[model samples]
Target: MSHSMRPLLPNSPNPPRIETSSSSSSSSQHRTKRVATPAACEACRRRKSKCSAERPRCSVCVERQTPCEYTTLPTETHLRAQRRKLSNLEIRCQAYEDLFGILRSRSEEEIAQILQRLRTGEDAQTIVKTVQDGDLLLQLSLKPEFRFRYIFPYSGEMPRHLKDAQNPYIRSLLYEKTVTHLVQPPMYIETLKEISDESQKMYIAPYHTVELDDPRISSMIVSNWTTVSSDNPMLRMLLQIYFVFEFPFHPCFHKDFFLEDMFIGITRFCSPLLVNAVLATAWHGYTRMKNRAEYWQPHNLGYRFLAEALRLFELEQETPTITTVQAAAIINLVYNLNGIDELGWVYTHKSFGMAQKISLFTPNPEESTEWQMVAGVTAWCLFNWQALITFHTFQPPVINDPPSRPLPDVDEEPAYYGEILVKYPFGKEPVRIYNGSVFKAISQFRVILNDITKSFFNPSRTYSPISFEAAIEFRSKLRIWYEDLPQPLQARHIVLPCHLKIHIHYHIVLISLFEPHLHTDNAYNGVNPDMIVSQSRICFETLMRIYYLRHGFECLDTTLVQFLHLLGFSTLDEISVTENGSAANEAIRSTLMLCAKGLWEQGQNYYLSEAVFRMLRQSMSVEDVTILGDIVEVEDGDGPLNLMAQELRSRWPIGAFSKADDSKDRTLEHFIHWWQQYSEEKAQDISAMEQDGPVVPPRYPQRYGT
Candidate 1:
């Protein structure tokens, strides 16, 4: 037969083929037989016949009506693939087991409680504590994949500004050294037990008092009391303003109780010092609101009331109570309002001392009285005030350190003074009452402020440059604290005084964080010039915002003055680097001038403001003279111009003039003469420039440029 016509079959000594008897039977009976190898099938192997290795059943086994099975081991490649699949399954099983273990350890009740609190907007720290106590958090933390899942899940998407490593403030906070130092276990007061006795006595010393023998002082106090008791129109208005404006920012007393007491003729029961302090604070706020310059004089109504309050406080024979501490804090605030920072610091110190004496810092847990809550809030206020003073004056805080006692939880209490309706972007609604949460947040920020002061601004500490990492960590914490604030406290556009103050303080901390870089040419080594300029602009913008909000009224306090001083120095530095008459340079100059003019107007008792104003004026005069091409020579300080330059150089080391170019320096006297002669000419140019645009840079000779 031909190869094409032959039936296919396995090779064998004798191939079997069926013969057809009939056409139909032939088609069915004629079949091809397949061969099997030795390894193909058990049936074929046992029968000693060749079989095809097909799946399910080999051809030889099928034709014989027997089952087929392979008994060979798998190849190494196949085994490896199977082992990989099994390993993946084992890993998934282990993960599930870990999750189940965590769930098993946490009771349903505990998890339910945590979920309920989270739904109700409980503080993040409280919720974290709940989970941590249940040990579920611990398990999650132990695993690398789940470490940040619960605690800091949002860390992956931080704000762009925060993530920028080139940003000086952020850079400082990100420094590894800073993070390590900040996160270390706090150093406890090891000598607490040893010094407990002495500390108690020392704290109480501020409250020890002799009975008042001065009849005049007592009569003045009595008169002030009569005025408050009678509710004269002016006094009533002041009190209302205090409640509406000042009290929210500095809540020393419960508003409802104070108002109720006043209405019920309970003024007699209240301490005279406390009453006088309130009157003084109210009057101070009123005068500032009214922009009454005369009322800020030494013997004005505010000062008289403040003096009487101090006199009564000094004469009290009893131990200082919550009211007494409140009185001291109010009086301290009054001092700050009058731009007497030294006195403000003194009074704040006394208030903190009295607060410590009464154990306000370490309150009795058994007591849940309103007074206890007020005392706790007062302690935190004192801490905030102390931090501000420390930052501004570069002084160490007299309050020792942050208290270990937790802040009072008073959110459940009724809102003080009912709901204060405030007009906001979301329409008029009751402003959120400042409660324990606000107090606690501010207290926490104060602790950070204290650290910053010690690390960067403390005059007593040995000079230590703040690492970029430390600054960034602090800044990060501040930002997180702000971001995590309750909706009510996070209003930026509402213009609530208390809320504004919080915002201002936050920016103040930011300014302080960048202030070190401002003096990069002097102390801060290797800091970028761009960073200094940017930070200075931030400070100016923040100050300008405050100025616009208050419109220069009631904003001349120590903190404000210090802010302006820093702004002045920073502006001068900015001007020194930027080209004169350029838009950037002029904008900085305008801000400096505006700040100087404002400070000069309100800077009667404020020495710091006066100094800042003078510096700004000097800087402006130097810029003007330089623009007019009046270069002065200082060779051995022979001429009046040379003397003037030397004096200017001494006063302002970071002045507009380049130190390398000794001929650029000009003395105050020489500057004054030049200003007098150039005033009219400059006015016309400035006016024209204001109407048109920035003045063109004037061409100068090579010697003059030098």
Candidate 2:
């Protein structure tokens, strides 16, 4: 306590007294006192000014009207007094020095902050450390803002623009740090506490790291890339596109936080390879870029971006990161979309291999960081993606075990962030509802689908006994899943393309499951031909709505094409058995026409669709096939999609369809000629059947495991 604040005793000869109080001490002549304090500012003494003293003045000192103090050292709490006075003097000295600095006015905010700290009684050393560690003050110290870009490790595939940088940042970049793959997942704060507290086992490790510090790569990257991000303009634009269009279905990474991390340069979730891979996949969404048609071309901007990611993948393969797996998976998606199945499968193996090496399949939620839980959620997504593709393409999945991780808490950001905005896709007023409701729903549904894949489908067809009861069991689970879906995601309520896609996918999977059992089962008469026809009609109508609404853009997707052609194959089978004008026949015809039109529409976006459409036509009579092609286009309709299709199809790779003599001719006439030739050949086979006692058609491997 200061002398003025100390209690006064009436008996004391020199009792401390307030000047305002009526007392004998006040009437006495105001006596001067001499005092000294430890660590008083020498600078202030030299200047002959009052310095570093903020304590209240005594009554005698106030009555004497002194401007400064001359006192003996503080007698009480002497040690504490010395430290406090010393810290105060040091802080004041810093303030004085900053006041005359050449950049004094520029650091007004920083200096004011320091003064505020002093007033708040913070220790001097802490304030100094804070200022030293922070960049804001250092930045203000420069005339122009200092450029403090970080050099990220580059692969041989570092974009050609930024090699051989001579800056200090590259010196650190040249040090190849052997890092583990601990890719963070999309996490919400609410679900974090539910995560397991178990420590991760370090037994399984994806090892190997090399110094990727090629001076050439540094030059190529120049100053374009940062520790967590690249300066690519396309990275930002395509990322938004991927989230808006693709993320709703997959929900692979947490969209909002992932974007925030990219902007603020957080390294855990976002990486250079992942960014480029995302860009490559999102390239399909770049429908109207300067009137160019580079959908599947090797030399487009997105492909070049993939080329960079490819090199990075090789460079980072030995020491795989969570983002490396993500990048590889996305690259697989792009390649598969373009019908590069071998490369797509190759990358799938690569991605799945990395996932295995990192023990991503092993659930270790104990003592979990939010990122680990996120990785768990993301693991589910990647496993589903890998499983679905593998099952569809006749390859068994390598990632067999499902991860047991905490579910994303849906109510966390329930109101904001993920509101779905459906526009022209709907005829009524658009609905805007929270999108996160479906994420958990999709994850749960994929779990069942993964089970179905392991049970029935494989390259060897090991589970051969096509049990009608088992199919019914699987179908029951599907119904239960649909019934349990959130209200907005249900039929008549779904508005977004992402929601509609799940519905269509459900019915398509049902069709594939039931189609093979129809011919050989008397015990399973529950699945009649009419039932199959109804499902086909549902898929056709739902699919056409998606295409015509300008909402769905899976036109670049070959898997959707596979589904479309599967419906066509069923429609053809129906045509052989049903008479014209019958309900089944009429259903078959509508399904066939819509399927053909869908192929034609999808072909406008990708050349492969046109060839696939005509190939289906060769199975029907010329008169019937021509009728399928005579349908009118949707009115005032698909304006955006039509433009995208036109632009995308404007240029094609030289050998897009096939390198036949007439390959260059993509005109309708050339296709018709080809279809007619195939039809005539089929007719010749029919003629040979009369003599050869029913010639069998060319064999196709069993489409369904049955």
Candidate 3:
């Protein structure tokens, strides 16, 4: 046979041909597969071979130096879209031709019948549906016959000098056609133009404007734009205007824009630029100008200032490195100035901005400087204070009631500071400062409160009702963090001591805020004016006594102690009055007596009432003479004390209930009796400490050890 016509057979002497075919099949099966195999380019296709989709040239194209083009399969949706567009264009052209024919022939009745038939058909033009008033207006503009008559309302008042100034109606029609007619979703173009013109005239602000005769239409446009939100520049600009200006500053403000609601809306609806602007303005304005009463108008009352503060706090706690002491100070100033009355206001909402700040300012030991850490701590404290206050506010309601309503859907998905720590598109970062321990401590304290608050609310019978548990936990955490800090930082910052007394003071304050009635629950009639005044007196007395007791006048920064003295904590017995040279001891006795009396009488707890007087009568040597000179008067009368003591002594022991002595022997009767006294005693002690600012340890020598 000829060589050209010959074909290889497996039985022939060439065994390699059969093996090659087997190998080829095996390799094909084992080959790594791509999503789609790249095909030969057009240039390579013409030559009939493989082509790699490479830049400048594919392998075949490179060698041959020919142009290459890669082809991809069009998606089904894309092909459908293309066909639909073509079909619509065809319909538009047909309608145009039909209309022109009707106009040219002047066949009005025939045109009407054709239009009616087209309207009933499936593939008719959208404009052919029922003709609207706007359609008539459009037809007048399009038909040269009606155009002049429609434009000039009057019969014949054409002025030769105003030739260029054509009819107003004609001018409007032409302007709309030129500028807006081609845009889709056919709006009343003339109406929008009129609104634009009117708004410009009234507001005197030359900006892009969209108008509609229907207020609902304008609202729908605003609402729809919000619904189709994107992180694009145009969308952000729209959001800024809608939130900051249109929503807040518009002449017609909505009633839904309550103070808290307005602020919440701004936080939710505004662009980041608008948020930052409002925040900076609010912060700087509050700090530099006047308080909210002066700076904020009645119209601005609906913004939730408290919630924003809480948001700031949450942000700081998550990322303490970037937030600063100044930020904390500013927040503190705001909080105090506003005189935060309810916890719910603080708890109502969380903040993304705060969360973002935390993430951006996350701390690193090697990279972070001291100032940065301080700022971070400050921010952290601000966040914790927010949560802490909210938690505090919620605790009482949770304790007293199951919940009148489902806990306000305020904060959900409590944001982690680290989540937002990445660099933002805007090159803004939180304030940085040194020593983040304060922030950490405050954060833990708030967290402790949160845990306790939650525990109090949790539907568990085993949970203790004692408020001290939270205080103890908070004190423990505070101590751990405080002690761990370097001594220099502590000395410089005046790190607050997390002692029993300090904890007690807060406990009373919290109780007062949450359940003021708890102060006089045991008192006769529960509405005693004397009891109320006494409770107030005890609170002040305790706080002041603690200040002098724990950190004596000598222990305190002398200037601070002197300042306190100057502020009006005058001593009772002068050096000249104690001629017996027992001035120090007598004065110390009198100070302790005053503190005990203040706590016993003012605090409406019967058990504490008896315990305080008993301790006062059982004289003990005084080690701190400074306390005697540092006492402040209760300023209120003492009838509540006598009544409380009489009630307690009649019902329980004269001595305060010692838990150690009573725990094993504790019966329901004994426990009730002891608790009655203990609760009273504890309440008084806490009140005293709260009032005194420093708590005094008992003066007796080693009673527990002996």
Candidate 4:
């Protein structure tokens, strides 16, 4: 094309020349001479931009012409072949060295040498050609049954590519025994039996590996759907879960692991069926109720999976849907975001990451998938809101500076506390924070519940006052029963400890605050004893109902007696209050005595008898005292009461305040009446005192009462 643009070959053996002439006779002579050259005009050397030697048209034709016809040089196939052969030779040599290095690294002898050294009962040797076969052969060789020896012990050589065997007899062993053991997952069921029957952690699934995070496992799951059994719902669930929660790790490896080129390799490898199966499994898990406990329970694999599933569903919602079931399914799946507010679940760390990822693909609100994802995320957000609302009820407002002594008029709206439901004291911030969190969580639950139900044309059901009251009592009694239990047994009996406790607390605070509204018998216009008692009953019933509904028989019959007694009802199946009180008092006394003994051992001066006396007096009712029988005599006399009286008498001095028998007799009557009143009043006080027992430190030894 141009003189300077002529093709130059670095390996060329020779260069060509070109000539041009003005005269026809000179051109004729030049043409005759130049016709013998093999190379084309494009490959010819030229002086500046012009040709020198004359040809058929000469220099005048070349200068005047706008175009020059030139034949380009062809590549030398022989030279190319020679270069290719050199490259192939280099590659072959490198491969041979790599193979040798691999074999040395693995401490393996040449196949021929291994075969020559083979003894009786040696493991089988495999010779493979392909890389896959080499890998398999290597795996077989590493088995425990294979007794491979290194040529150089100190060199620490390892096996190379046995399949491309320079030597062909490297023995590979099938570790039948080891493989069998591996195949047989250990029976943790037996070890579980050794523990007391009261353990709950036993119910938690065993964690062999967090497979959802494993790239290889994830890829295999996504790419090999045909081989995956339908019965392995867990696997499918897990894959979907991972896809949603852990979007980065797809098929199993990170999408970025393909060097930001996307998981082209893995995606290419995954058949369409595998992708469908994974998605189907996820959708299935979301629609079914089987995963609720597994999904929502804090820190479980199900939770991780559910989170991932939500993400995947959010991503998938952009496409067309066949039915409302799919819509409802996706909505319900996102509804689980509400469950993320549970203890030990930090949404900021886990769920927020998913949100950010979602934001990347979803920016427009009008898009259907965006809306679906938004609805799901909003449902999650609402759950937090519900938690926040629940938190405010129990949380006392903490007023700072000019204290929030009086609430503002309903008409005077503030940004935060303007809403009647949110109007709480700023002083009780701690409790408010706790209640707020619960309110937020519950609100999210309600929101998602409403949203999904509405989508499916099923309106959400609000709890009626009666239902709400039932819920309160049910949960409160459940709490009391749970708290009354021996500590170890409590956790086992309770399904969700935080939820149970929160429910009780929330109801208690609500009833206390809204007694005027919550009371059953509106007889006492506002905040009266009837109101208090009715509100209390409402709380108690609600708590109990919720507890029973949430956790079944393990908590059944638990607070039946205390609950009936609180409600002023009697039941034949109930334990007598007197019996319970007596037992409680005895336990309290025994505990106090043990504490007193410890104080005594520590060289404390006061008698443990005094502490024991205080504990009994504080914990025992007249009924308890009566049941104690002869133990109620004075210290100077035979009974506990007499003993106490003797001590009082000694302190007061019986003779100092009395005149003759007339004054003494009147005083005696007054004293007896006063004593009865005091005993009656002190009974409840004592019971309360025992209930306020301390947690004994482990290092302290138990002591019997004084």
State the C-alpha lDDT per candidate.
0.48, 0.50, 0.32, 0.29
What's the TM-score of every candidate structure?
0.50, 0.54, 0.24, 0.22
TM-score of structure candidate 1: 0.50
Estimate, for each residue in 74-127, the C-alpha lDDT of model 2 and write its tens digit.
343445666778877865655344333312322466677767878898865556
User: What is model 4's C-alpha RMSD?
Assistant: 28.8
Could you give candidate 1's per-residue lDDT for residues 54-114 as a string of tens digits? 6678888788788787654232233465676787686455434333333343458755765
| Runs in model 3 lying further than 4 Å from the true structure | 1-292, 295-347, 350-383, 391-435, 458-464, 467-477, 488-706
* Candidate 3 positional error at 525, Å: 37
Tell me, by TM-score, which candidate is best. 2
Candidate 2 backbone clash number: 30
**Candidates sorted on TM-score, descending:** 2, 1, 3, 4
| Model 3: ten consecutive residues of lowest lDDT | 418-427
Off by over 4 Å in 2: 1-235, 289-298, 366-369, 412-434, 457-465, 524-559, 575-590, 604-611, 617-621, 624-706
- CA deviation > 4 Å runs, candidate 4: 1-346, 349-365, 373-509, 512-706
lDDT (10s digit) by residue, model 3, range 519-558: 3333333334334333433333333433332222211011
Choose 1 or 4, whichever is better by TM-score.
1
| lDDT-best of 1 and 2 | 2
